[model samples]
Target: MSDLHCPARILLVDQRPAGALAERLSRESLAATYDAPVDLDEVADRHRGETVLVVGPLPAEHAHAGGPVVLVEVDADGRRTSPWDVPR
Candidate 1:
């Protein structure tokens, strides 16, 4: 079960949230949460872990100085962007 009051262990930022995926992730006992780009900052602040994996379209702004954030871009076809191509 995910603790809403505490920071999330995994933050899944998907423009189109997939119910099945979110549910599956939660079953693993990790505090997984669904969110959009606009709420990245607010959500990031609530992150119990340091890394964040975005599984859909890239957010307009997701960079923060609070901690290390890892954003992964996934296309409509479910193709993930290469790590080498990700911005520093």
Candidate 2:
């Protein structure tokens, strides 16, 4: 399917804690955000419906988790890039 209609929930994985990012994502009009530690397998199983996974400074282990995975590096500039960045 086209990227515009990707059917997957958005999962945000981070090692530095997901409080700040989750808050920001929740405030935005984007997809809902699920906060979890950097556990690929667990996160994958629990949120299997996830089509787009956003990782913050965490390794990209869920790349092969049966869907498109977006790796986002939380840089010092506070910039985060992910599949979600694509305009709706």
Candidate 3:
């Protein structure tokens, strides 16, 4: 069985490393998660048209990606904020 409605690109992440997210989502069937170094080159080349859910302290580089990039941040107090929405 497969989720036909699921988007081609879906990513879930937190403060942990990119590799951590990739490894965790490995058990799933649709999405593909990979190691995302500070440079983020791997993610750019591999995942082209996916909505990356970076759910933690988003890296500076990711904030400037060419495609659709989502920056999710959770503070120590456990509050979630959209990083891009905050004042620069």
Candidate 4:
């Protein structure tokens, strides 16, 4: 379960390396980290029970696990070009 007062851990699950995107997010005050889909179990253990906020597309297993997955596009200038919400 997620604790409202505790911030959720952020994960960027992309087909390509998201290092630049992660840096941009940091500049925007949204700190995030990236991990291979296969390393998700380690990530979960690292964060304990805190919710994991995943961005971009994920594998079917994580996609259906009930946490929100935000689809966003950040342009070259670090501006979000496309944004949409996927309801649980």
What order do candidates take by TM-score, descending?
A: 4, 1, 2, 3
lDDT of 2 by residue, 1-88 (tens): 2232223344455433245554545554533344444554443334433333444544545443322235333322332435433222
Estimate, for each residue in 39-84, the C-alpha lDDT of model 4 and write its tens digit. 5545444444243434446665444433333332322232221222
For candidate 1, the C-alpha RMSD (Å) to the true structure equals 11.5
Sorted by lDDT (best first), the order is 2, 4, 1, 3
What are the per-residue Cα lDDT tens digits for candidate 3 across 5-85? 332333424444345444543444533444444334343334443434334434554444322234332222332323232
> Which of the numbered candidates is closest to the native, going by highest TM-score?
4
lDDT of 2 at 80: 41
Error of 2 at 62 (Å): 7.9
- Go through the candidates in order and give the C-alpha RMSD of each one to the true structure: 11.5, 11.1, 11.9, 11.5
> For model 3, what is the C-alpha lDDT against the true structure?
0.37
Alpha-carbon local distance difference test for all models: 0.39, 0.41, 0.37, 0.40
lDDT for predicted candidate 4 compared with the true structure: 0.40
TM-score of each candidate structure, all chains considered together: 0.30, 0.30, 0.28, 0.32
Q: What is the lDDT of residue 77 in candidate 2?
A: 38
**Candidate 4: segments with Cα more than 4 A from true spot:** 1-8, 15-24, 28-32, 48-57, 63-88
Model 4 residue-pair collision total = 0
Per-model tally of clashing residue pairs: 0, 2, 0, 0
Error of 4 at 53 (Å): 8.8
